[model samples]
Target: MTSIEETAPGRDHFTDFDLDSPEFTEDYEQVLGDLVAKCPVAHSKVAGGYYVVSRYDDVRQCAQDWETFSSEGGFEPGRGGEGGAKLYPVELDPPYQTRWRNALGPYFSPRAIRSREANIREQVNYLIDGFIEKGRVDFVEEFAAHLPGRVFFGSFLGVPFSELPPIQKATDDAMRGPMEGRGEAWVAVATFLDGYLRARQEEPPRDDFIDVILAGVEDHDGNPCSWDHKLYVLTDLLAGGIGTTTYLLAGIAHHLATHPEDRAALAEDRSLWSGAIEEFIRYYASIVALGRTATRPTEVAGQSIAEGDFLMLSFAAACRDPKYFENPHEIDIRRKIAVNPAFSFGPHRCIGSHIARLEATISLEEILRRLPDLALAEGGEPVYSNSTIARNMDSLVVTFTPGEREGRTE
Candidate 1:
């Protein structure tokens, strides 16, 4: 599809940029390309009134300036927290954000990550075993979703496997599901977490995240973290940890199936996997956009904004900015990226970044070694949802060289 600039004649400001429309989202590179070139800072009327900052410097500025752009506001304009639940650490700034980060950060500390590595490696191989001999499988359903579902739900979060389906469905819907159904989707997520968190609060077994937080994690005031805040943070982990990684792994599979040369190069040299994963993240940034409500009147990228306005920091777009990257569109695994804002920027950056990279890197190394010739499955169409929030593939059907699994024994 031609860019809005070329076809729209004298139309300077773009209103055709709808994140929820696949027509716009499926072709995100081209869409963001146009925005970066023609409109660094543009307004969208989609979710009421908001500005999208598409440039690298501008987005970094907005993300770094927590006082000006507050994550505390619910995604949309005019919306705030639910009851007393702030959006956990991401939604908070300064002393509160610091308190929560310090308290829960230990859960994913280096020692914790090293402990999980063995299981993560085992799980990757186990999931591959299910489809390695079959020669074809929906990578998303059988592998991408299952790997994280097991890792995040069963291992990390300690959520009952029985409850995963509804929780996963609710989060997926709330982030990228239909517009009319969004309220229900969000409500479903909160309801499940509310019950689960409330139960954990009473029990205080300290076995998992909820137990730890409920048992003793304190707020800025050194008081026990509020129940509502705990729920929000738990939701953040469930939603963020599961959703982002699922799509990214599927995206790596999609890229490998389509690009034979890069796949061959990586398979030929195991060392390339580390650097390649970084490039892959830069290419397919999963968290499409994060919201911030302007606390005071401010200008981004030389564009003026009012105090009450909301802003969208497009990390996906920022990663694609040519000013920061040499060949912004092309995927060059060998390229040494000075920096990529895929995990976001500043204090609000994702906390689970180390574990996420470990998951992707290990999964890729094993999958490539075991299923060397996997190709996009014939007669099946893959799906990527077009949404304002998350960018994830729904399905990735793939066929591989058969009997590769039989050659190796666990």
Candidate 2:
């Protein structure tokens, strides 16, 4: 695998695109736009090679037709087994995947997520209180990055908040660390999850999500899932809940800080925040691309994909397809999005999307209310890191008028 710093450039994107390349990280929107128009299904030789599906329609078709483009092989290109433990459901095909979704979906439904909004809002305000008085802060590190884990642990997963730091660090390293170190990072994450799950099993059942996971579901053949498989599911939830939401939050914060006019509009009209949140999710999709393997021979946008070939379905690119979204580059809060691919599509569509939206909406509302004068500080440009699975913002600094804390919570 090529490192981002060592990634060579000047290759034809249509024939040899690399998602991990610095080119993709720097010119993400442009590279995908060209591909969507010129070569909807472009090939890449990175990580033993794979094809990229850039257009909205093609990416959706591939994601929806999981049988033709199987995920059981894992979602990373080239590294395949080397990418660390397989995340359940996202890496599973139907029947078994469906079973898991059926068993767990209710916990993440809009209604269920809404019930936790108070908890989410409390955490959002609490985090802001920590930095509201500082007058300056790294938005990503100080706020966007921490809220999701706090909510996930406190409201959904029932884990101790103290356990979040190490798990969060290990998760970050596994996803964005050096190539050789990622696997070890994943092992550390897995070890933590393993113990957490076992400890939950030993305690009296709380009838919560964790206990539901411990109950275990049937495999395709009706066999009970392994303890390790349960850990995979839990790990996937933690990563999806925390890591992806962090990017969305950071992106929204950066946009608000840079475009005060837009922020003002949203601040004046709280109802617009919902649409703006959706627009932000579409514009700054957290997972840039995810891999799907050809279960057999298939064709996408006139490109012939051989059996067992890996394809990177660029959801970030799909969201920007001109055919699907008019004025694809601009953020239109009122633009009616018939279908947003930001959370992906088909059977494997993200189950935590409601959580993400609610979290974003609350965070945006609080930030604008508390940090209304928020603006980018001098030399404060967002730092980003790209990978086959996701794109993340590492830092975003902002300055705001100092505000008083609302007093500590019990």
Q: What TM-score does structure 1 among the candidates reach?
A: 0.87
For this target, which candidate reaches the highest lDDT against the unseen true structure?
A: 2
Clashing pairs in model 1? Answer: none
Give the alpha carbon lDDT tens digit for every residue of 123-179 in model 1: 788778777778889998787876765677656766755665677677667755668
lDDT of 2 by residue, 1-410 (tens): 22223333455677778888887788777677777777788888878888889889888999999989988877787545545567887888898999889888888899888999887887888788888889999998888888887787767766555666777677767766678998899889788778888888789987667877898899868999987778888888987777689999999999999998999899889878778888999998888888899989878988888998999898999999989799899988777777789888999999999999999998888888899989999999999988667889989999999999984543
Quote the lDDT for 159 in model 2. 59
Task: List the candidates' TM-scores in order.
Answer: 0.87, 0.93
Write down the lDDT that model 1 would get. Answer: 0.76
| Clash-forming residue pairs, model 2 | none
Q: Say which candidate scores most in TM-score.
A: 2
